[model samples]
Target: MISAYACGPGDEPEAAAGWAFALAASTFCDVVVVTRRRFEGAISSALAARPELAQSLRVIYLDRHPALVALKRGQAGIYWYYVLWQRSLRRLVSRLHEQLPFDVVHHVTFANDWLPCGLVGATSAPLVWGPVGGASASPVRLARWLGVRGSITELVREAITRPLRRLWGDRAAREASVVVAQNHDVARRFAPVTAHAVVEANASILSDDLAAGAASSAAPNLVGPRRAVFVGRLISWKGARIAIAAMADLQDWTFDIYGEGYDRGYLERQVRRLGITDRVRFRGHRPRTEVLAALAEADALVFPSMHDQAGWVAAEASALGCPVVCLPFGGPPVLADVNAHVVSLERDLPAALARTVAALPRGRGERSHRWDAGRLPRFLEQTYDRACATSAVAEERPGRRRVPRPARAQRR
Candidate 1:
């Protein structure tokens, strides 16, 4: 597995996904995980606590050059750094494959479809890409919700990156044996490139963790003044402002936002301006355990991310039997069960949130939905089997072989 941004001891969404996938993979087979040097400490610490994992998991940490590290301060900087890292990674993997002759290589993270996976077609081994995403776009009608600066920022970003994404992502999709899209939007985007594309959400919860959470909590009281929680970065696209806006009318409910980002000041100001400071609290970034604890206790999760490929917290909250009020778009809708409230764009977001909260029944126990943790390893194994079979058929077909493109310029 080639996961450039894998996290184990960390709590970011990408990191959590990477770590979970790695753990799940190790349960089935010997796993070699390639990740950034920055995560070595976290991965090492996690492995130290589990000797069984240490025996089966071989980790190779590749360091980012100091110059590149210093340059990666903003979004553009990070993207460029990732490009350089991919270039370096290809060389490293080529050398590793000479000795190991891997049967299949799975490119796991930074799950953006816009970014090319270096391993695709670089080695003789069959390659699987994704569950990759980045296809969701913020609805134009919701532009005013982000305010002027955020709206401009989003528009500028889209204008600059969309063309490049199509050019590069198309190429990457073409080279993959199977493209595992995180959501329907990403699958649609990749449809032109490959027939083997499939939708399997990247976010999942551990069965044991869900069991523990369920055993620990009794039914939540659905009585007066319900408590709503928002778990995610306080960015413009995350739509935390929509949750805060809804708090103005629902004076009976209190909202606790549990993450920090550049938009903290803007959100705090919005809260003050609405005179709902007492009802809304911005609890800066909390640890994963803490966030889950809060979710287990809260009445509902108000998530209105305009362009989230998948909001992992929404899935976690649902696994804990907590109701989620989210936009009908994105990965949340796929992960959310019948208990969740999907707010459509036809109605005002804030009004919809208020209505969902008011109508939600209290004293609900933990949900019984089966977590995806057990399913991912099997899905990955099936993808590998399919890729291997396809590769075998292509190898035997005379005059059907396509010339491999250079890693730097390759795209679907």
Candidate 2:
């Protein structure tokens, strides 16, 4: 059986849970989720969302001292705790290393790019990681296409960062026997260098049992008029604020802002100051299942994510037949082909939103439901089998040490 590790919240958990659910039900594999003390609740909460798959998951919550929890909760010292507090992490990794058995340690991170390859090097098992680093080719291309001439300084900065990005990937990716890229865009970046790099888009939604809750044949007409829903953290570059400002002139439309972050209070204040308090609603963080359900009920998923690579929300919404109003952030070339109403922040956002809203066809006809559990497991199983096969072949090769298959961690 293959073993995987899920660290932190966000897409990491979504991908991990989906893979685990698939692995458990179809392939003979198991997943153990490891998280800091504070995020233990998040793991349980994630598992509770899918009761059918809960039995297959084994959750391990590391309860360090209370001081660590407090430090993690506070925004100020998080960096210090994450990197500087090496002793704590070493103790935690040592303890986990001893307790759980992972043949292939998979760290599903926001940007697999940030971590050092040496991180899991201490372990005996081979590591398969990625979607690494948060980058989108679309946005950069979009930025260039717009002809907003970058100053010499900006060009110099890019030149410097370009090499650094490569170095970062080389250092982190060189250590992994297998590196998975969720989108073709990301896969292309590593295609030239890493022979092990594989493109594997998220295969989670195939198992969601949406058919059980059969609804009327009539289109899901959300009671509210021409509503746009944007789900994500309320941060500056996220471009949700741009969506809000864009919808400002559209008197008939309402924007429901879900999810929370450092800018919650600031965004709330901006909504009121802009006199859009009545038009824009801040429905701070909801459960992930509820969030998806809510997306299904909306007219369009308005995602103006500027910094993110592939907006999973867009994919989820699109899968549900919910049209997406997006500002291209790059990655996932599939979005261009999927049912999406494209917009750009580089251009006049408000005008673009106004045009998109006015031009939108009344309702989506027959779009696939965002997530279905059954198909995803089969896909993941194939990937796992392929990875194992590759390992076996490498073992057969002359002068190469074969990677051991992961041992299942005992359930807690």
Candidate 3:
């Protein structure tokens, strides 16, 4: 059984990752997916289209209070609501387990590590507690770019998480059979607490025609103005400013912003203030098809997000054979792989990214990104096997003591 509170119609990170894992696991065995009632329409629509999946997949939807649901619509206290919903799942999980014991209990969505996850404690079934993150944070020096409000927010979050990790993070990790961290920093944060932390990206190649795009855009000749795009919610921490700041120096490139948020004003101001008004275009949110097409044709994706747990855009861009210029921090470094030029935060970040963006076309031919079509299934298969094996060993040991798996954490 998997707890996927965010599973729904779109390819948002949590929803996509949760649905992807459930689909991948169904290829191996029957999958019991526990999600919110709100997604029933979309999920049912999808299953109706794929009859074969309906046979092996069982979905149980939990209803949330209307007040909480309404609050979530405006993006207020949603994670708090998620935590309450998760905490309430113990009874449901226990009842389900009593009727038919599950082989594994996986936590898929609300991937942040700081939150309380009741599913982890609800069953003795071997646990898979990620691919989760939230430990990654922006460097104080570089985060000054976020302005005073952003700076204080990060400072407060770091302060709060430190104690919270000690209080609960350690226990959660220690109990998890396999802690799948979304990034290396998150993995390292959980390492001392759990012996089974592994770094794996939560975002996979989810689009239908992405493989075709990946094959065709493997290498390209760049002869005209370079096109670099950023596709994400324009929030303060997303660091659209970093990309906008870099654009001033990148005369050969034209950056098209594909999403909008409150930060749109700040970012647009920066574009004008930089006097590169002609070079930058705030082409607000477009359809997914258009975004994918933009990625397929773009020279590079300049995504300089500060602490993104999993960058869906970076992974999609990379799979489309578009070079990614991202910071060495967060999920982009893991997902982009050889298809990217990771810009470090040490020197002038915008300048570093500018140089990387300028040189990306030449850099692509020097490296190869072997797109693994089977990466998701293969990962899910191994994770479940390892979870079962580890749980079996724990049951055999005195006091049901957890035993760490022999597999060392993957570095790449």
Candidate 4:
């Protein structure tokens, strides 16, 4: 059984994660997924093409109070809605399990480390929580300069999450047979509460044609780095401004930015102020294919995200054999593990980016893929086996979930 509060549409991060995780789990076992009712159409359409998954994968969409829907606009009360939904899910799953008799229960989405999981006492079956995140934070040095809007948003978010971390932190981790953290930071946060914490990225589809446009275009400029690309929302923490700042130093190089957001105006202004208007172009929200193609053709993917739990663009950039220049912190450092340059956060952000490009390794072989289909299934098998084994141990122990801490390297 999979509890993915957000599922389908294949767009929102949580929904994408839920859909990917549930799909992967279904490959190993029959999956009964519980998700929000709004996603029914997208999920149904996705399942339609894959008739094989029709029988093995069943989705249950649960709707929330009509008032909650109103509050969810602009994420005003989305947290409130999710909290109430999770509380209600406990009851739904308890009744569902009496009829279905699930062997293992998994809570797969809304990948926030602090968000409470409802599956804690819903069933006796082994529980798999997370591959979740939300522990990452924007660099204090960079965040302060993002003007009033960005600064306040980060401040307000941190303010809210700090206390909730102490409150819901234990409940989300302790009861699980396995707590699959999306990154090292998330794993560390749960370590104090549960011995089952392990670092594993949320599974994503590995395209069969990863080699389709894997070839890197030759650097056209003789003077400096030729070209760079960035794909993702143009939010303050996403570091699009930093990427644009870097373009100032790469005089001959061109930087193309995809995607639009509240920060687009700010980023564009920074570009003009940097006096790199000719080189830095904002291509606001392009198709994924166009973005991927641009990635293939670019010299580097400068994704300097401040606090990404699972930098999916970094993974995609790496898959296309593009060099990734990202921060030493957060999910980008892990996902952009090869053909990549990790630069430290400094006041002179542009210089760091320039130095990274100069230091980039070229003519590299195929990089490691964390989400390869063959690899993820094998990993899941081990995780399930481990969860069941530990669950058996917990059953014998009763009233306590204890196991030796995983070795340091394994912890990551």
> In terms of TM-score, which candidate is strongest?
3
Task: Give the poorly placed runs of model 2, Cα more than 4 Å off.
Answer: 1-27, 30-70, 75-103, 109-111, 117-119, 123-126, 137-168, 201-219, 222-225, 248-252, 261-278, 284-293, 331-337, 344-346, 392-412
Runs off by more than 4 Å, candidate 3: 71-73, 207-221, 362-373, 399-412
On lDDT, the leading prediction is 3
lDDT of 4 at 154: 90
- Please estimate how well model 1 matches the true structure, expressed as its whole-model Cα lDDT: 0.77
Worst 10 residues of 3 by lDDT: 403-412
> Can you give the lDDT of residue 343 in candidate 4?
89
Residue 296 of model 3: what lDDT?
80
Write model 1 residue lDDT over 244-264, tens digit each, in one string. 888898878899999998899
- Candidate 1 global Cα RMSD: 4.7
Query: In candidate 4, residue 111 scores what lDDT?
Result: 80
For each candidate in turn, the TM-score is 0.88, 0.67, 0.90, 0.89
Candidate 1 segments exceeding 4 Å error: 207-219, 273-275, 365-372, 394-398, 402-412
Order the candidate numbers by lDDT, best to worst: 3, 1, 4, 2
lDDT of 2 by residue, 194-253 (tens): 668775544345334233212312356745577778888766556666677677777777
In candidate 2, position 179 carries an lDDT of 71
Candidate lDDT values, in order: 0.77, 0.56, 0.78, 0.76
lDDT by residue (tens digit), candidate 4, 26-65: 7777789999888998998988888888767899878777
